[model samples]
Target chain A: MPKLKRTDPDERATDFVESLDRGLRLLQVFGTISGPATLSDLARAADLPRATARRILFTLAHGGFVATDGKLFALTPHVLTLSGSYLRSNQVVTVLQPVLDRIATAAQEISSLALLDGDDVVFVARSSPTRMFSAGLDIGYRLPSFCTSVGRAMLGRLDDAELAARLKAMRREAVTPQTVTDPKKLLAAIIADRAKGYSLVDREAEPHFRSISVPVRRYDGTIVAAINMGAHVDRVPKQELIERFLPLLRDGADDVKNRLL
Target chain B: MPKLKRTDPDERATDFVESLDRGLRLLQVFGTISGPATLSDLARAADLPRATARRILFTLAHGGFVATDGKLFALTPHVLTLSGSYLRSNQVVTVLQPVLDRIATAAQEISSLALLDGDDVVFVARSSPTRMFSAGLDIGYRLPSFCTSVGRAMLGRLDDAELAARLKAMRREAVTPQTVTDPKKLLAAIIADRAKGYSLVDREAEPHFRSISVPVRRYDGTIVAAINMGAHVDRVPKQELIERFLPLLRDGADDVKNRLL
Candidate 1:
């Protein structure tokens, strides 16, 4: 019998299957939608032909990642295992959870860790203080990096070319009156924040909310993510925030970096 | 172009791509491990031959779900989108988050929502009171159904045969001295909990931790999940948990069921 040719490095393209890419994209289509989706809805959303979508859905159902009522398809809890694996391997969120807990209570505000993903920042872990309103964010919630404190802090760590490319790529549309949408202004602000070792965005993501963030860095000086404490503007002024909570944010970042080891 | 065969109900076998199946299995292997793993480690853990594992890993890495440092591979935060879509579509956890938050703050304890997955209960959402220790669980942590209050509350809502099969499949060994390991005794306790509209687990998971839980049911009386409040034994005794917190749990459950509509 002939060998599968996987032993040769150049034959990797033959070994790497393309259908798996399509299958994962199918799952992503299901995620972007709001509720249970029909087969045609998924096919259209994923930009795949209906027949291919159906077969992939069948395979997914057989795999336990999905379940359907013979019409509407939704993912099962088993899918969480995929995210669970990521969280477990990353270890930063798990190890720094205690530190985040402390920062929230000590600062009496909501705190979170967010990693830069493309032009968005994804909240990886969060701790909330008891309050009248929520931050309206869950673990996987995303927000444009140019308009958020956590996003800016993470962005401040990138090299000049990367930062310029990402800023050029962003929509740069203002979310609020205070949002910095101009690419040049955003870059100058990021450079300033980097010099100050943190980013403090006031009434940017929301009118009432302000976030103060510090980039979590490895011992080698590479930024891994950002940690922040968010409070209502009326509850805490920007100056008081820097004085009272900045230390906790810095400590949280240090604790997170230590966990990356 | 030749017509794709998905139009025929009998042709699913042709559509189930084997490579996609193996690719998912590889991700599961990463979930099982605690940290970054080598290619051989993943192959052995996933029970796949090294070539298949390498090819699948290549596919996953290209998909941006898996990242490596030339030696060890790990899942990236982007994988959360798979579960994120599930959570977003399910709507139960998102709607009930406020209720869980209110319950946590009102009762001065931690509250979580869990759904039954096979023989285990998986926490889908959680909120914690400002405290020193964590709830020690994240989104997808699983535990045996018979020992924990959330598990037993959901089990209480199940019909006899379903509950019996789940109980029979459980390990049933004591996690703590307080855990009820015998099936008949566990079933009787579940029946008792069902009769009372909630389940109270006293130090079942740990000697110092106690929890009270209630089943979340649809308007049609079909149970969907369980919501629970967990506190330390020294802070809240079992009787006060029943008297003070049981009503809150039921209210939260009712609120959750309304969101199912």
Candidate 2:
């Protein structure tokens, strides 16, 4: 994964609290590994010295966010409070959850809400029907902004200069045979989505998966996020998505805008 | 809320990262407040010096875990990665989510799985049917063990001495009119649940909520978590819960135990 971009030069200055940043980075490293990690494993993955990693681990364990069985360290359920704090305090999820749940039930597919964080679209809220795709696209799942339906929908709201800049900064790749990798073509697709009020992608994010997304606007008429519903290509034909799910998604986005403060 | 217990004397020694602990505690304080907070608000709530809190907030902002509009600071969607990391790494939620979803759909109610964390049970996975109660019982919701059905189900698995100690340590309060506050009665109820292999609570956690829970065990027969289904009291009678939900919850628990490694 790419590192978080440091926009400010004073990140290394005295006011930054370097150990706090290292400790949080270590927490993110746990997600990249499969199971419990030893001190050496964490130090190697986080690119920190063993002594610094050990101190951070000690602090995390003392905070009840990480647990240890003497030899290996793993995150505890207490870590959920950090996410819970964000979900509960943020108004976007609170406003969009029920709206997306209604859309998911009506569409009989997985519905999700995502926001553009840096260059990736990070899913923040989701509502799933009984039947779902095997992609495991739960909350916090992230995908690059140049290819996903939700990403295109959200990027459509950006100004021309910013859109071109993000598109240039992205490590554009053909993740699937159908993914559009050319910068000019990607820009044209996003521009078309801006005119159409929605975006549709076919087999770009995952094979046999098709999704349509609509941008969610706030009370001030500014786009805050994007909402999408998706299904398998065999299950949902491309034409049917534009006919059935597009209106439903647009309605859901409108409801969210009206409800959001 | 009470602070995390520090059992190791070495917490005050050189190896501990005090700023990291303070920064995490500040994150928790955000959950206790309403929306965006000023530096003074966070410093007061976290009980840290203004300068200390300011530096930590800067570090968190640099890490993309927080956002600021110059005057007020709020958590960004990036914070969800912390909880997402825990969920993705923890095997228990991976095994229980599908089982709980099936149970919830079949029962037409809300089903959840929670693990024992200190004196509280933190909800880690949940599935809700089309209709749900007004309470926001999403993942990461926390309730005291002495009153909630899932809490009692898991607490019943603890050794006698430890269970008694936790019960005594709790700040025992009557959250609702129907809550059981007496320590002896709470212990008796939990012990009965142990014998019966399930726990049922009527209007204890909330005024009109009732739930039935079954403990989820691992391959070694040690309880790791608990699963439950709940409904409004008027919608589900006590006898109906035992006859209908109890069997379903037990089957779900058995399925989780079998699947978990």
Candidate 3:
């Protein structure tokens, strides 16, 4: 099993330089669980003592990045400026969104853009109709890279040595019955994805859901991210996913690369 | 004139504490000005010396928030995770996006959620159809509070003293012929917005565009933000804006409030 590393609050708090890391950890705590948290809840969530959590919350509130209503502390709209800055600076989102919108409208399925982050894929942009799914996957959801189409597409871009290292460190526990747990089979699947120029994941991360993904390349021809079109297995047959969705996904990726380049 | 602060790069460079601010400024420089920038381009945009810009850019590149190709630097999708944290932490965005989407779909116009920042309004979220006129508004875009329907709606939420203080510090300038440049008239508009529960502006920020806006309240009854629907003047007449768009904007605000609460 891969060793699980807990965010060490004590180690983070020991040095003044690490306080930034501590502050980021406090921010990260908000995403690890669902719902808003009170000061006490934040302290427990961040694994910091109550007094330390109070100071960090106070400072964040003073900076207008977080809001407190005399009880619970939640993020403020100003916090979006941090991420909005990222989206704005990176023109790929602006370039990709219209393409994703077109794909979503044409295919009538959920379309998403994701990037590799340590053994996980973080969703950066998505376009979907309201009735398709009640649990709306917004801009921040992170999922394990081993089980999702976007993950496989991104991993397929990496060289064998790096890919092997990543596979060696992956946690192989099944998220669903169809999840690829065997290392050798997963490696083969990744190799197949590279040859095919796209990846198709079926009921791996969640049962009854199918996703097809293609890599988004930069002007230099390096794979920086991947795009995916996802839907229920009943709504989209595997053959239909490849035939109908794959072309649109590839076209969208090409458009993004063209506009960005 | 309101004091224009120069972002002090020298003070920022020596202090490790200011690294966050420096890093954030580097990200801000990338917003819409250019796709990829050389070190000198970043220095000019960030108003820093080449050396300072190089250091910050190098650190960001090392952190995977940016990618450099020897000559030019560009932001990567990994930066989205920072804003993603903020979006997930604030439950309001989840509640608000659907309402904004509905308004955009209904009106076939640009709809946005904005929050007050000092004497300005900063857009946090926006939804728009392909034919919609954006008026150059994007998330994190800031504009004066006196000249926009969304700005007036948010300003209406402030008490008299707070409102006066904000107005007193602002430098009123003509954006377009219809812009409200008079302080007294702007104050009256704000008061009227409070009484009517909405604000409307015609050709104020730009020619041939009109907008209607309403405040989004939290469960505690505080106006946390405002939402706006914008259309070309030819599509939405003054009366039509108040009659048709107002209810949609208000309904969207109410829906957002219900979900958030």
Point to the candidate with the largest TM-score: 2
**Chain A only: TM-score per candidate:** 0.88, 0.92, 0.85
Ten contiguous residues with the weakest lDDT in model 3 chain B: B1-10
Query: DockQ for the candidate 1 complex?
Result: 0.37
Q: What is the alpha-carbon interface RMSD for each candidate? A: 7.6, 5.6, 9.5
Determine which window of 10 residues in candidate 1 chain A has minimal summed lDDT.
A1-10
Candidate 3, A117-228: lDDT as tens digits: 6688987777764332212225656789989999999998778878877887898778888898887788889999988999999999998998999999877677778999
> Which scores greater on lDDT, model 1 or model 2?
2
Candidate 2: regions farther than 4 A off: A1-12, A129-137, A258-261, B1-12, B129-137, B258-261
TM-score of chain B of each: 0.88, 0.92, 0.83
Residue-level lDDT for A183 in candidate 3: 77
Q: Estimate each model's TM-score.
A: 0.89, 0.91, 0.80
> In candidate 3, which residue ranges exceed 4 Å CA deviation?
A1-17, A32-44, A47-63, A67-73, A108-110, A127-137, A254-261, B1-23, B30-74, B101-111, B126-141, B252-261
Please give the distance, in angstroms, between residue B82's alpha carbon in candidate 1 and its true position after superposition.
Answer: 2.0
Looking at model 2, the pairs that clash are none
In model 1, the Cα lDDT at residue B75 comes to: 76
Q: Write the per-residue lDDT of candidate 2 for residues A182-212, one digit (tens) a residue.
A: 8888998999899999999999988899899
> Cα deviation in Å at residue B76, candidate 1?
1.7
Candidate 2: tens digits of C-alpha lDDT, residues B1-261: 111232333444788899999999999999888778888999999999998998998899888888775567888888878887888888888888888778877888878889888889998887766642212226778898889999999998878888888798888899999999898889889998999999999999999999999999887788889999888888889999999999999888887676665
